[model samples]
Target: MITQTISLYNWTNGVIMIAIFGLVCLTLIGILINFMMSGKKKDKTEN
Candidate 1:
């Protein structure tokens, strides 16, 4: 019973780690897109 509980704990931790990783990846993509769009607008305005 103890071993089963430990196994479940490990599985839950792994799932949480994966979720955090995915969230960070999505945040990075959004920042990159915003940066690119802003840069293009700046360049167009300068010219």
Candidate 2:
């Protein structure tokens, strides 16, 4: 029973870590996309 509990805890921890990592990655991608779009707009207006 103790072993099972420990395994469950480990699984939950891993899932939480993965979720956090995914969120960070998504945020970075969003930032990069926004930056690129704004840059293109600026370039178009300047040209």
Candidate 3:
């Protein structure tokens, strides 16, 4: 029973870690896109 519990804990933790990593990656991508768009706007105004 203890071994089964341990296995379950590990599986859940792994799933949680994967979800968090995915969320962080998405956030980083969003920030990068926003930065690129702002740069484009700045260039247009300068010209």
Residue 47 in candidate 3, Cα distance off native in Å:
5.1
Of the candidates shown, which would achieve the greatest TM-score relative to the real structure?
A: 2
How many backbone clashes does every candidate have?
Answer: 0, 0, 0
Question: What CA root-mean-square deviation does each model show from the true structure?
Answer: 3.8, 4.0, 3.7
Q: lDDT tens string, model 2, 1-47?
A: 89978887687789999999999999999999999988865455766
Each prediction's Cα lDDT score?
A: 0.89, 0.88, 0.89
The 10 consecutive residues of candidate 2 with the worst lDDT sum are: 38-47
C-alpha TM-score for every candidate: 0.68, 0.69, 0.69
What tens digits encode model 3's per-residue C-alpha lDDT throughout 1-47? 99988887787789999999999999999999999988865455766
**Could you tell me the lDDT of residue 36 within candidate 2?**
92
- What's the distance in Å from true for residue 22, model 3? 0.3
Error of 1 at 15 (Å): 0.3
